[model samples]
Target chain A: MSNNISLWLRYKAKLVVTNVSWGLLTFSSRYRAGMLLLFLGLTLALFQSGNPRFLSYRMVSTILAQCAEVGLMSLGMSIAWMLNGIDLSVNDLANLSALIVAMFLRSIFRPTNETVLLICSLAIALTIGLAGGALNGLLIGYLNIPPILTTLGTMSLFRGISMGLTEGKTISRLPSALAVFGRTTVLAIPTPFVILLLSCLFMYYLFSFTTYGFKTKMTGLNPKAAFFAGVHTKRAVFTGYIFSGLLASLAGIIIIGRTLSVAYEYGTQTYIIFALLVLNLAGIKPGSYDVLALLVAVVLLQTLATGFYSKFLTLQGGPFFNLFLWGLVLVVVLALSRAMERWVSTRS
Target chain B: MKLTRLLRHEVVLCLFCVFVVLSIGSINPAFFSLATIFEVIRGAIPYMLMGLGVMPVMLTGEIDISFVAIAASASLATHNVLIRHLRYQGGLAGYLLIGLPMGAFLGAIVGAVSVFSGLPLFPVSLGFWLMLYGFNLFFISPEMRFDLPPGLTGFYRRFLVTVKDPVVGETGLHLAIVYVLVVGALLAIILRYSTFGRGLYISGGNKDVAIRSGYKLGKLLIVAMTLNGGLAAFAGILQCAFKRFFDPILFRGAELFVIAACVVGGVAIGGGRGSVPGVLAGVFFVQLITRGLVYLGIKPVWHQFVLGSILLGFIVFITTRQKLWVIFGRRKR
Candidate 1:
C-alpha cells in the first residue's frame, strides 16, 4: 500500500508538471492574448461566485454546442480566408439549409423512425447544402464576380427565400428520431460534438496533406505567386465556396436537429460576428487548422458569457458591454498577433 | 447643350421618376393625385436622409455600417426624454428640437469611437451597432412600444405634405420633404465647392498620400462621422414619428441599403470618386424600386429578396472592372 501510494504521487507530480509547461507554452503564443482573456474570464467567474465550480460541466457543454456551429462555419471560412476571399453569406446559407431540410422532412417523411426516412432526410439535407454552395460558386466562379459582392447578393437572396417560404414563421415539429440524433450522446457527448470532431479531423487532413489545400493557402498568401506556380485560382475559390456552403448546410442540420425547429430569423445576422470571432480565435493562417485553438476560444467565450450573466443584474446597459468587449478583444488579438509575429521573427 | 448634358447625366434619376409615376399612376390612379404625390415624396424622406449622410463618407472610400443603430438609439433616447419631460403636448417644432440633438449626440459618440480606435470602420462600426442594438432592446420594452404625449404625436402629423387642388381641395405634404431638399442642397454645395469636401475626396482617394501631404485625415473622419450621425438621427426621428412606435428591429437591415445607395450612386467603394448628385440619384433609384414594389402589392419577403438581388448586382457591377478578371485564353485548359 505504501509503494502504490508513492507511485501514484510520483505519477501525479509528472502530470502537474506537464500541465504547467503546456500552460506556459500557451502563454508564449500569439494565442496567449486569447489565453489572457480566458484567464481574466476564469478569474471573474471565480470572483463572482467565490468558487471556480460555478463554471459547471453543463455550462461548458452548452458552450461547446454554441461554438460547434460557429466552429463548423469557421472551418469553411478559414478555407475561404486561405483562398484570399470571404463568404459573407455563410450564416444565411446555414439558415437556408436548415429551413430547406425542415421543409423537406415535414412534407415527405411524415415523422418516421424508419431507416429509409432517415436516409432520405440526410440525403436531402446534404443536397440542399450543396445546392446553396453551388449557387454561390456559380456566381463567383463562372460569372467571375468579386467574391465580396457575389456573396453579399447571395446572402440577401437566400435569406429572402428562407423568409418567404416560411412567411417569417418557425418550423417546429421535427421527427422524434432525428431530434434524438441531435440531442443523444455517447458517454455524455452530444451528436453535434461528435460531428464537429469528425469534421475538424477531416478538414485537418484536407488542409494539411492535400495538394489542393497547399495550392489554396499558397494562393491566399500571395495570389500572384500562386498563379505563377500554376494553381487554378478560380477553381480553388469555387471549391472554397462549395465547402463553405456544405459546412453551412451541416450547421443548419445540426441547429434544427438540436432546436427541433427552423425559422427565417434563425441564423440571420450571426454570420459576421461568429465567423470573425472563430477565424480570429483559431489563429487563422494559410493551411493551419487548429482544433485545440478554436476549442479554447469557445470555452473562453462561453465562460465570459456566464460571468457576464451572473455579475451584472443591472439593466444599465450591461449586456451591450459583452458585445463591445468581444469586438475589442478581436481587434486587440489581431493587433497583438501581428506584433508578436514581428517580435518572434526578430528574436529568431 | 447644358440642358442636354444634364438630361444625359441624370438619366437614372429620370428613369426612377418615370418608374415611380407609372407605378403609382397604375396602382390607385389617385396615386398621382396631388395628395398622393406629396405622400410619396414624404415617404422618401428617410432614404434621402441616408443617401445625403453617406455620400461624403463614400466619396472618401470608407463605409459606415453603424447608421441604423445610431439612428435607433437617438430616436429612442429622444422618445424616452420627451416622454419624461415633454409631457405637456408640445407642437411639431418642440419635438424636432429635442429629438434632433438626442440623435446627433448618439451619432457623435459612434463617430468619436470610430475616429479614435484606428480600426477599420466596418468592424468598429459593427461593434457600435451591436452595442447600441442591445441597449435599445433592453431600454424600451424588448417588444419596443413607445407612448408619446398627445401633443407630440399630433405634432408629427405636420410632417405630412398638404396639397389643395381646384377639384380635389387641400391635401397635406410632409415637412420632411423640405428637410430632404435642404439637406441635399447643403451636401451638394459642400461636395462641389468646399475644401472640407475636397479633403474627404483626397483622404479616401489616397490615405497615405493624404497623410503625407499634411491633411488632417483623422479629424476629417470625425467630421464625416458626425455629419453622418446627425443626418441618420434626423432620418430616425422622421421615421419613428412616421411609424409612431419604437421597435428594436426597426431599421435592422437599413445600413446595407444605405451603403447600396452610395454604391449605386457611382461612388467608388474604395473612396474619393463619387458626387453628391450621384448619391441623390442612387437614392431616387432605390426609392423608386421599393415604391414600385409596394404599388404592385408585392409581398414583403419578395420585396426584400429583390432588393437583396439588386444590391448584390450593383456591388458586383461596381467592383468588377474588366481589368481584374481577364481570362488569358491559354490558361483555360
Candidate 2:
C-alpha cells in the first residue's frame, strides 16, 4: 500500500509540476499583480507575530468546527458548479433537512438511548436530505430551467418549509450520541474532519474511477458534444444537482447533530461562502480528488483564520477579516487559472 | 396568442394579485379600503425602490448582492448626517438631497472592488457585506438605535399618495414611489435606446469578444458597479424615509430576495439578456407570492418552502437546455 501510495504521489506531483512549469514558460508575458498580492498576504500572516507558531492545530480545529457546515456544503456546491451550474438553494435545503430531522425526532421519539437513537436519527436525516436533493435534480434535469434562477427560487422556498416545520422555534432535544458524533474527538481529531475525509474519498472514487464521473465532466466541458456522443447530458446535470442537494442535507445533519439543536438562522448566511470557496479553490472539475482538494483548501483557510486570531490581533469579528481574505484569495485563484488555461492552449 | 405568450410570465403575477384582492375582499371587506390598500402599496415602496435600482445590473446579467449591505451602510451614514450633523441647519431638503448621493458614492467604492477583483460575484460582494455590517456597528453604537426625524416622516406621510378605493380603485403612490417608477422607466429607456446600455449587453453576452472588439471590459464593469452602487445608496435612504428608522437588520438577507426577483424575471446568470419590464414583473411576482400565501391563511413557513422549491424548479428550467426528445414529445417513438 505504501509503495502504491508513493508511486501515485510521485506521478501526480510530476504531472502538476510539468503543467505549472509549462504554464509559467508560456503565459510568462502577462503581469501577475494578483498573485503578488496573495504572496504578500501569506508572508504577512506567516511573520507578523512575536511567534506565529501559536497559530497551531488546536486553533484551526476549532475554527473548522465553527465553519464546517458551509465547508461541507461547498463539497456539493463544487460538483454543481463543475457542470457549469450552481444550486443557490443549498443553504435553505440544508436548513430544511435539519428542521425536518429536529421536528421528527422530537415529535416521535422520547429522549432516551444515546447510541441507538443517534444512529436512527442519522438514518432519518440522510433519507430526508436525499429526498430534498432528488427533488431539485428532478426539477432541473427534466424541466430545462436555469440552475441559478431555479436554485434562487428554491432557496427561498426551502427555507420557508424549514421555517414552517419548526414554527419559528429552536429545537434542541437531540440525543447525546448525536452530540458526541458532532463534538467528540477520536484520536485527537474532530469527527467532522473525519467525515469530511471520508466524503472526499467517496467523491474521489465517484469522479475519478467511474464511467459516470467521466460523463459528468464531458457534459460540463461541452454539452453539445457530450449529447452527440450519446451521453444523457440532462441526466448528468440532474444527478449533479441531486448529489449537491444530498450533500447539503448531510451537512445540515452534521451541523444540527453537532449542536444538538437546530436554529432557523443557522444555514441562511453561509450559502454564498460555500459557493465562492468551492468555485475559487476547486476549479471546475467534478472528481473525488478535486473535492478532497477543496476540503484541504477549507482547512488551509481555517488555519489562516487561526493565525489571525492567535497573533493577538483584534479577533473581535474575526469572521469579517477572514471573509476579506477569502475574497482576495478567490480573485487570485481565478486569475491564475485563467492565465494557466491560456498558457496551456497556446502551447498545445 | 402572441401577445399572451409575450405576457405568459406576467400571468402568474396577475393571478397572485387577483387572489390577494379577492381574499381580502372576502375577509375584511374593508381590507381593500383605499386607506388599507394605500398602506400595502406604501409598504411595497422600499422593495420596489431596490428592485428598480438593481434591475439594470440584472438586465446586463450581472448582480450586486452587496447592494443591500451598501444600502444599509449608506443609510447608517445618512442617519449620522441627519441626526448628528443636520441638527444645526433645520433645513430638511439639503439633508435629504446630500444624503442620497453620499450613500451612493460609498456603494460605488464596493462596485469598484468587484470589477477590479476579477473573482466570482459572491466573495467580493460578501467581503463588502461584512465590512458594511461592521462599519455600521462600529460607526454607530452597536447598542445604540435611533429614529428618523418626525419632520421627514411627516413629509412622506403627507405627500405620498395612498390607494384610492379598496376594491376597485388605484393603489397608493408616494414621492418615493414616483422616484422608483422614474428610475425603472429611465432604465427601460436607457437599456432600449442608449449606446452605453447596448455596450453593457454586449459585454455581458460575450466578454472575450467584447474585449477583442476593443471594448474596455474593466471600465464597463466599473460602470455597471457604479450604477448598482448609486442605486443601492438611493434605495437605502428611501428605506430610511419609508421605515422611519435605520434598523440595522431592516434588510437582512435581502440580497437573495433581490437576486431571486431578477432571476425570476429571466435574467441570465453569466451576464446579459434580461429586460427592465421583466425585472419589475419579477419583483411584483415575488412580493405577490409572499403576500398571497399569508392572505390564504397558510403558515408563513410554507411560503418559504414553496419559494425555495419554485426557485429550484425555475433555476433548473432556465439553466439546462431541454432535450430534443422532451421538446418533440418523445421524438415520434
Candidate 3:
C-alpha cells in the first residue's frame, strides 16, 4: 500500500512538473478569456466615465433583457459548432417558430385560459423547433450534406415558409399574457434573464453529466474514432441539431415575448454574425465549452450595445460602429489567442 | 457512354428551362415570348458575376463570404471617389477600370489575413465580412446616393434588342449580356485550359494530393481570392449601373442566396469540380424558379420557400444517390 501510494504521488508529481508546469499560460484559451474579461471591465469603466448612467441598475436590467435572444441563439450555435458544423438556419428557424406560435395564439380571441394557451403555444414551438432541427440533422447526418450548406438551404427555406404564410405581414400584438416572459421580473431580474439562466444551467448539466453530452463531444472531436469506439455518431449529430433547434425555437418565443410581434425577417443577416462573434470570443469548443465565459461574453456584448446606443448615438455613424468594432475584435481576438498559444508553447 | 456523359446536369438544366418556359407559356401565352427568356438571362448577370467571382475560391476548396464585403467596399469606395471627390463619371469604362483593381486588392487582403492569422479561411472570411461592411458603412458612407454621373445616366435603357409589346410597352435584351458571355468564356478558359487554373482543380479535389504533388496552396489561395474580389467588384459596379443608383446597402443580403444558386447550378459544395457555364446555368436556374413564379400566379413571397425547398431537395438528391445505392446493394448482398 505504501509503494502504491508513492507511485501515485510520483506520477502526479511528474504530471505537475514535466507535463502541466502549473502556469497560467498553459491553457491559453482560458488566458485569452481572462484577458477578454479584463477588457470588458475596462470598457465598462471607460463607458461609465464617459457617461455616469452607463452603470445603473436599470441599464443592467435592460442589458439582461436584450441579451436573452442572442444568448440563446449563441447557445444553439455552440452546439452546432461542436460538431465542426454550423446552423445558419437558427435565426430564421427561431423566427418561423415564433411566428407559428403567434399565429396559434392569435386565433384565440378570448384569453380566459391564458396559461393553457401559453403551454399549448410552447408545445407547438417545441414541435416546430424539433422538426426543423431534425430536418437539418437528417440532411447533415444521413444525407451527408455539408453543415453550412445544409443550414444555408434550411435558412432560406424557413424564411420562405414564414413569408408564404404571412405574405410579409408582421403579426402584431400577440396575446398579452404570452409576452409575460418579456414583462415579469423575479427579484428585479427579468423573466427573459431567468430563462437564459435556466438554459445555461440546463446546457451545463446536459454537457457535463449526460451520456448525450459525452456522445456529442466525442463525435465532435472525431466521428470516425467515436464510431470505432462504439459511439452512434450519426444519432449524436441528429440529437445535437435537435437540441440546437430547440434552443433557437425557445429564442424565437422570447423574441415574441419582447416585441409581441413576429416578422419573417426578425434577426436578419447580422443576427448570425453576432452569435458567431460571441462563440468565437468565448473560445467555445466541443468538449470544453465554458458556460460562464459564454454568459460573460453575452453580457459584455449587451453592455457595449447599450453603451453605444445611449452614449454615442450621434457620433461615428451610430450602430455601424459597433459592427465595425465587433469585426475588428473578432480578427484581433482570434489572432491574439493563436499567437498567445504559440508563444506559450514555445516558451517552456 | 461518351454521348450520355455529355447529357449531364447542364443538359438537364436546358431541358428544365424548356419545360418551365413551355409550361408557363401554355398557362399564359403572353409569357411564352422569347423576350421574357432574354429578360431572365439579363437579370441573371449580376448573380452570374457574383457566382463567377466565388467559383475560383470555391475551387480552392475554401468557402468565401468576404467577397460580398469586398464588392460593397470596392464599389462604394469607387463611387465615393467618382461621385464625391472626382465628380468625373465620363463613361462605364472608368467605373470598371477603377473598381476591378480595388476589388482585387481587397480580396488579396482577405487572403493575407487568412494566411497570417493561421485560421481556417471560413472564419477569417467571416471576420472580414463583418469588419469590411461595417467599416465601409461607418467610415465611408452610410446614406445611399441615387444621383448618377452624367455618363451612366440613361444607361439602364441601353438594350441590345427591343420588342414592342402591346401590353408591356417594350422589353428587350440588355446590352449587359455581352459582359456575362465574355466573362464566362474567360473564366472557362482559365479554369479548364490554363495550367494555373488546373491547380485549383487538384487542390480543391484533395489537399493532401495537391501538396504531395507540390502545389503552393498559399499562393493559390491568394490568387483565387484576388480573382474573386475582382469579379465581385465588377458585378457590384454592373449592378449599380443597371439599377441606376449607388447604394451603401447594395447586395446587403445576397451572399447566401448567390451561394445557394451557384450550388444548384451544379457547383459542388466542397469544390474542385464545376465549370463556368455550369455556374451560369445555376444562376439561370435560380432566376427562373424565383421570377417565373410571378408568371405562374404564385405570390412573390413564396419564392423564398421554393428556392429553399429546391436547394435542400436538390442537394440531398445530388449527394445521396450513391450512398443509397451502396446501402441497397449491401442489403441485396
Candidate 4:
C-alpha cells in the first residue's frame, strides 16, 4: 500500500510539471496582455460602480448564469474556427433543439411524469443536434460548400423549421424538473456554471490528450498537408462541426431550463456575437488554455453588463446602451489584440 | 446555335423566372395582373440594388456584410437631416447627397481597415455590422417614422409609364423602376466595358497575377466597397421613399438575402465570374419564389425554408458540375 501511494504521488508530480510547462508555452505574451486588460477592465468597472454588490455572491452567480450559454457556445465555436470553418447555424441550432424538446415535452408527455419527460426531451434534443451537425459536416466536408455559405443556408433552414414547428409562438409550461439543471445552485455555484465548468474540463481533455484533437489542429493549420501526412482531414472537419452542434444543443437545453420556455427567436441576435467575441478575446488561438481564456472573457463581459445595468438602472434604452458597450468592447479588444500580435511578431 | 450560345445562366434564370410567373398565373390569374407584376418589380428593387452593389466587391474576392447596416444608417441619416430641415435646399438631391456620401465614407473606412489589418473582410465587416447596428438602435427611436418631403414624394410616386388592364384595373410604373433600370444599365456598362471592371475580374481571379500586372489591390478594394456602399445607400433611400416610413428594423438580415441572390445568379462567390444581368435575374428569381408561394396559397413560414433549399441546391449543383468537368477534362487530356 505504501508503494502504491508513492507511485501515485510521483504520477501527480509529473502531471503538475507537464501541466505547468504546457500552460507556460500556450500562455503567450498576447494572452498575458489580454488577461491584463481583462483584469484592468474589471477593476475599473468595480471602482466606477462603488457598489459593494459588484462583488457580492449573488452578483457573481448572476454573471455566471448569464454567461453560461454564451460560454458553452464559444467553446464550440472555437473548435469550429480552429478547423478553419465556422458554424453560423449554432445559434439557430440551439433554438431548434430547445424548441424541439419543448414541443415534445408539451405535446406528448403528461406533467406528472416530469423526470421521464425531461430525460426523453434531452435525448431527443441531442439526437436532433447530432443529425443537424452531421448534415453540416457532410455538406462541408464531402460536398465542398464553403463553410460560411453552408452555415448561412443551414441557419435559415433551421430557423425556418423552428418557426414552422412553433408557428411563430413560444413553447412554455416545460416540466419543473429541468430547473434543477438550469436554475438551481450546486455547491454554492449556479448549476449552469457548473455545467459550463464540467464542459470546459471535458474540452480540455479532448483537445489536449486526444489524437483526434491533434489531427484536427493539423487539418486546421494545413488541410492538404495534413491529408498528405495521413490525417483524415475530412473526418476531422466533420467531427468538429458535429461537436459544435452537440455543444450548441447542450446550450439550448440550458437556455430552455433557465427560461422555462423556448422561442424560435431565442439567442438569435446574441449567441453568434458572444461566441465571436470570446473567440476574438482568446486571440483565435486553438489550444486547451483557450477554454480558460473564454471563461475569463465571459466573466469580464457579464460583469460589465451587470455593472452597466446597475449603474444606469433608470436610463432609457437600456438594451441599446448595453449593445453599444458590447460592440465597443469587442472592437477595442480585437484591434488591441491585433496590434499586440503585430508588435510581438516584430519583436521576435 | 447562336441563340443557344447566348443562353447561359442569365438566360436560364430569365427562363426560370418566366416559368414561375406563368405557373403562378395558371394557379391564380390575379398573379399575372399588371399591378402584381409592378409590385414584384418594386419589391425586387432593393435586393437588386444590393446585388449590384455587392457584385463588384465579390468580384474582387472580398465581401462586405455590413451593407445592410450601412443602408439602415444611411436611411436614418437622411431621415434625420430631412426631418430637421438641415442646411440643404435641393430636397431629394439634398437627402441623396447626405445619405450617399455617408455610406461611401463608411464603406471606405471598412475597406481601409480590412486592407491595413490584414484580416479577412468577413470579420471586419461583421464588427462594423455590430457597431452600426448598435448605433442605429441607440440613436433611432423605434417609433420614429417619416414621410418623404412633398417634392420628393411627388417625384418618387410619379409614373414613368402606365399600362391599362381591364382585369386588374390600371397600374402605373413608378420612378423607382426607372431608377433600377438606370442603375442596372450603368452598372452593366461599368462591369462589362470599363477598364476598372476588367481589373476587378483579374484581381478576383488571381490576386498575385493582378499584382504582378501592376494593379493596386488596396485601391481597387476601396473603390469596390465604396461603390457597394453607395448603391446600398441608394437602395435604402428608395425603400424609405417606397414605404414612406423609417423603421430601425427595416432590412434586417437583408445582406444575406442580397448575397444569396448574387450567388444564385451565377455570380461566383470566389469572384471574377459573374454579370450584372445574372444578378438581376437572380434578384427576380428570389422575389418570384417568395411571391409565388403567396400566390400558391402556401404558408409564408415555408418561404425561408424553400429559399434556403434552393440556394443549397444551386451551390451543390454548381460545385459538383465543376468537379465533374475537371475530372472529365483530365480524362480527355
Clashes of each: 15, 38, 1, 0
Off by over 4 Å in 2: A1-70, A110-116, A282-292, A307-348, B1-12, B81-92, B99-114, B120-123, B139-151, B160-172, B200-221, B263-278, B292-303, B306-333
Candidates in descending TM-score order: 3, 4, 1, 2
- Considering summed lDDT, which 10 consecutive residues are worst modelled in model 2 chain B? B320-329
Against the native complex, each candidate's DockQ, computed on alpha carbons, is 0.27, 0.38, 0.62, 0.43
Candidate 3 wrong stretches, greater than 4 Å = A1-24, A31-36, A108-111, A342-348, B1-4, B324-333
TM-score per candidate:
0.82, 0.80, 0.92, 0.91
For candidate 4, report its TM-score. Answer: 0.91
Residues A1-348, candidate 1: write the lDDT tens digits.
Answer: 999999999999999997785555555565644664666576655754664556566765666676667777776677776765667788888888788777877775454546766666667767877887887877776566656556767888888888888888888887766765477766787778778788888887887788988877777788778888899877777777788888887887788778888887774554476676666656666655565676556556555655665666464656655555555555555555555555555545
Worst 10 residues of 3 chain A by lDDT: A21-30
Q: Which stretches in model 4 have alpha-carbon errors above 4 Å? A: A1-41, A44-49, A110-112, A286-289, B1-7, B87-91, B164-170, B326-333
Q: Tens digit of lDDT per residue, candidate 2, span A217-265?
A: 8888888899999999989988887788777877887787688888876
lDDT of each: 0.70, 0.66, 0.84, 0.80
Residues B1-333 of candidate 3 have per-residue lDDT tens digits of 354467687787778778887887788787877677777877888889999989888887788888888888888889889888888868789888899999999999889888776776887788888888888879888887777888988777788989887645777888888988998899899888887799999988998988888888888889999999999999888888888877777787688778877777777888878788778888898888776788888988898898889888878876875576668667776
DockQ, ranked from best to worst: 3, 4, 2, 1
TM-score of chain A of each: 0.80, 0.78, 0.88, 0.86
Local lDDT at A73 for model 2? 81
The candidate, 1 or 3, that scores higher on lDDT is 3
- Model 2: per-residue Cα lDDT over B1-333, one tens digit each: 353355454565566567767775687565545555455556666666676667666645565677787777766776776678666334346545765676567656665665654554555666567656656655553533446565665645654554456344554555666766788888878877987777778888887877787877666666666677667777766666665667664586777777777767766766677776667667766676666556557786566676666555555555553353255545543
Best of the two (1, 4) by DockQ: 4
